[model samples]
Target: MRFFRAAYAVAWKDVLLELRRKETFTAMFFFSLLVLLMFNFTLNLDRTQVLSLAPGLLWLAITFTGVLGLGKGFLAERENECMDGLILSPVPRGAIFLG
Candidate 1:
């Protein structure tokens, strides 16, 4: 219960910050668009090939976008030097890692 609370707090902080600044949102939007465009243009797949490759391509986009989101969050925290503060907090390290 306490663990979840702390994690929620941390996650909420990120969410609020993102809502205020929208850096992560904007970056993620463009990143995903670029990824999809790249995949669409580079892959000239027919219906049969599409069935074989679509799942992997979908996962690739998901993974890339997820990575970009995490990177943006870390970058924001690093710029503000908030990461050290998080490390020193009483919250579980796993919560911080996750949030």
Candidate 2:
């Protein structure tokens, strides 16, 4: 279908860009690891203390990593002005947005 083709094109474009740059994954990995480590340090790790803090630590890492990764996603689009090109496309805006 035409819609599916366009969607694949956009996804493939992004995949190629990411493959060449490799910055986004590296940043996300390091940022996520740093968040996990920070949570561990602040909790004052110990046998008794560690068990109670597990959920809180995991949740904090997920929240922070998600926020950080989302920010980077926005930045990547902005950095190359890809958003502007997307906005100018003839396709339905919602489809572009969802992509």
Best by TM-score: 1
Error of 2 at 2 (Å): 5.2
- lDDT against the true structure, per candidate, is 0.87, 0.75
- Superposed on all Cα atoms, model 1 deviates from the true structure by an RMSD in Å of 1.7
| TM-score of candidate 2 on Cα atoms, chains taken together | 0.67
Kindly provide the TM-score of model 1 when superposed on the true structure, using C-alpha atoms.
0.83
Clashing pairs in model 1?
A: none
**lDDT by residue for model 1 (1-99), tens:** 888899889999988988997767888888888997899899897889988888888889889999988888788899999989999898899988777
Candidate 1 residues lying further than 4 Å off, grouped into runs, are: none
Residue range with the least summed lDDT across 10 consecutive positions in model 1? 21-30
lDDT of 2 by residue, 1-93 (tens): 666666777777766776776777788778878888877777677888888877787787778777876687778889989989977887666
Report the Cα lDDT for candidate 2.
0.75
The true-versus-predicted C-alpha distance at residue 36 of model 1, in Å, is 1.5
Check candidate 2 and list the clashing pairs: none
